[model samples]
Target: MKSRMHKGVSLILGLGTACTIGLSSLEPASALPWQQLIFNGVQLLQLSNISPQQTVALGQNIHQQVKQNYRLDSNSKTNAYVNRVGQRLAKASNCSQIPFRFYVVRDSSINAFATTGGYVYVHTGLLNAVDNEDQLASVIGHEIAHICNNDLINKLKQTQLAQGAASLAGLDQSAVTAIAYQLAVDLPNSREAEFNADDKGLQYMRRAGYNPKAMPAFLRKLVRQSSAPSFLSSHPATQERISVIERKIANGR
Candidate 1:
C-alpha cells in the first residue's frame, strides 16, 4: 500500500511538472531554461503504461475537463471555419482512420494543444493571429500530428503501472481530473515531439493542398516577436526547428 501511494505521488508530481511548463501565460520573466525543461521531459518519458483503450478513456476525460475549465467561443461561423480546416488536415493525415475533433478556446493567448486520441484545440488568440487559412492549417496540422502520432499515449505509457495500480485501488476521480487537467493544459512536449509534429503536420498540409512554406512563415513570425505568445513560449521554437523546416521546404519535400 505504501509503495502504491508513493507511485501515485510520483505520477502526480510528474504531471505537475508538465502543467508548470504548459502554463506559459503565467510564466515569469526568467522561465526555466529550455535545456532543463527538455531534460526533465526526457526523464518523464521513462515511465510508459497506458494502452489503446486507456488512451481513449484518458483523452475523453481531458477533453471534458478542457470544455469545463475553459470558455469556448460560441460563434457558429468561427467554429465552422476551424472545423473545416481541421477536417481537411485530418483527412490528409496518415492517422485519418481515427476520428478527429477541434474546438476554439475563447482565450486570447496564442496557443494550441492536443491530447490523447484525436482531440485538437485551438485558442481564439491563435486564430486572430494568423494571416490566412494556410497559416491556420499549419497550426491545426501540428496539433493533429500530435494525435496521429499518439505522442500523449507514448508519454503516458511511462506511467502505465502507476496508473493501473491507482485505478485498481479505486483512487478518487479528482486525482484523475487533476492529472488530466495538467495533461490538457500544463504539459509541454519535448523538442523531438515538437519537430515531429511540425514535420508530419507539414506533410498533411501539403497533401491537403496548402502551401508548405506557410508553416515556416508562421513559425518565423512567432519566433521574431519580442514578446512571444504562449504557443512560442511553451513550445520554445529553436533555430534548429526553423532551419529543418526551411531545408525541407527548399528541397521540395
Candidate 2:
C-alpha cells in the first residue's frame, strides 16, 4: 500500500484529509488550524504539515498505552543507560526538534518500536541480543526513522479513518474499536515505508558516529534467527532491505 501524504495546509486524500475533519471538529477549543490540527492528529502528517506540538501529544498517548500494556524496567540504571544512548541517536536524527525519549520494557521479547510522539521502546531481549553499542544504535536509528517519518501517525490516521467509515455504515463502537486497536498495534506500514526508514536510519547512525555497517550485521543476525519466535522477530528480515542498505553503504563510501 502507498503511504498517505499530507498536502501542506490543505486537505489531502486518505488519512491526513480525514484527520483534518475528525480531530479539528472534535476539539474546537484548540486554536490549531485545519492543517495544523490534522498534522497533530495523525502520525503520517508529522513529516509534512504536522507541527512538533501535535507530535509530542501523540507520543505521550502512545507511551501511556505502552506502559499500561508492558512492564517497564524498574532499575534506574538500565533506564538511564537506554535513555543516554537514545538521546545520542535522537540528536543525530533528521527530526532533532522532536524530543525523543527511550525506555526499556521489562519483557523478554526481542523487539523495539517507535511511537509517533517521539518515544522509542526497546525490549530487554533486544538489548541483550546485540553485540555492541553500534548494533544497538542501528536498531535505535531504525525506530527513530519510523517516528521522524511519521509512519506511526499515518498508520493511526488510517485506523481512525477506517473506524469512522465503519461507524457511518452502522458498525458498532465495539467493532470499530477492535479493528482500530489491531491496526494501531500491528502498524501495517507499506514495504516502501520500511525501505525508506532503513535508508534514513543508516544516515542517522552514520551521523551519530556509529558504525553504519552494524545495520547489515544486525539484520544478518535477525535473518539467521528468523525461526525463533521472539518479539523482534515480529518484523521478519528481508533481503530487499539488506540489499538497499548495502547499496547505501557503497554509495556513501
Clashing pairs in 1: 18-186, 19-186, 47-158, 47-159, 48-157, 48-158, 49-157, 49-158, 49-160
Report the error of model 1 at residue 53, Å.
Answer: 5.8
Query: Per-residue alpha-carbon lDDT of model 1 for 1-253, expressed as tens digits?
Result: 0111223645554644443222112112333321222232122222233334445665776777777678888999999999999999999999887768788889888888888767888999999899899999999999999887777654544343333333324334444444545655676676777888989999999999999888888888887888878887657455677899989888877
Error of 2 at 253 (Å): 7.3
TM-score, predicted candidate 1 vs. hidden true structure: 0.76
Residue ranges of candidate 1 with Cα displaced over 4 Å: 1-11, 15-54, 161-174
What is the Cα-based lDDT of residue 77 in candidate 2?
A: 89
Q: Among these predicted structures, which one has the highest TM-score?
A: 1
Candidate 2 lDDT for residue 30: 35
Taken over the whole model, the C-alpha lDDT of each candidate is 0.70, 0.65
Deviation from truth (RMSD, Å), model 2? 8.5
Candidate 2: which stretches are off by over 4 Å?
1-48, 160-184, 229-237
At residue 253, what lDDT does model 2 achieve?
A: 34
